[model samples]
Target: MTIEQMKRNARDKIINEIAFLAGGLTSACQVRAIICAYLYVDLVSDAEYREYCDLILQVENKRISQSDF
Candidate 1:
């Protein structure tokens, strides 16, 4: 699959795992384990992750500013 497709699939899997944790079918320890596994599979470096995080924060700030007006 393409990079975009892989990202989407990874995101979906993470969401599902979080939901399972929330539902108590999975323990907190299990959730942490899964998160570690996901992080390893993510492959993105710290710099790339930081850049994407900053972009998301910027978008969120802009949305909040617009809503306040």
Candidate 2:
């Protein structure tokens, strides 16, 4: 799959897992760590992986915000 596809798939997987695992109460650090575990340490470059994690973090944070209300 292309990078965009990978990113989308990763986002979906992470969000779903986080929602189910913690009922949308997970922290940013836990999200970041989960991203690292999913992205693969050696295959994906550090900078690119960080960018992907950042993107996912934004989405996850939005979920957290919505859940608060």
Candidate 3:
């Protein structure tokens, strides 16, 4: 698979796993913090990065249900 495709797969898995973490709410917040920092010095294009970031935000904000994953 292409690198972008691989990244998407990893992103999906990470986000989903974080959503269901032992203490999901706390984990989600921690992940969101990392995403914010990782945005800099990262190779992903803004659009790709946004997709991943959006998922975390949606989960933390309760805009999307973790069960939806």
Candidate achieving the largest TM-score = 1
TM-score of 1: 0.51
1-69: candidate 3 lDDT, tens digit per residue:
876775666566566656664346457666655555545635345775678667666666663464567
Q: Give me the runs in candidate 3 sitting further than 4 Å from their true place.
A: 1-13, 20-27, 61-69
Encode model 1's per-residue lDDT on 1-69: one tens digit a residue: 887787677556645755565454654455445445656777344554455445444544555577688
Score every model by TM-score.
Answer: 0.51, 0.43, 0.43
lDDT of 3: 0.60
Name the lDDT value of residue 18 in candidate 2. Answer: 59
Judged by whole-model lDDT over C-alpha atoms, candidate 2 comes out at 0.66
Measured with C-alpha atoms, the lDDT of residue 2 in candidate 1 is: 88
In candidate 3, what residue range of length 10 has the lowest lDDT sum? 36-45
Model 1 C-alpha lDDT versus the unseen true structure: 0.55
Clashes of each: 0, 0, 0
Q: How many Å off is the CA of 39 in candidate 1? A: 2.0
Q: Which of candidates 2 and 3 is the stronger one according to TM-score? A: 3
User: How do the candidates rank by TM-score, highest first?
Assistant: 1, 3, 2
Which window of 10 residues has the lowest lDDT sum in candidate 2?
Answer: 17-26
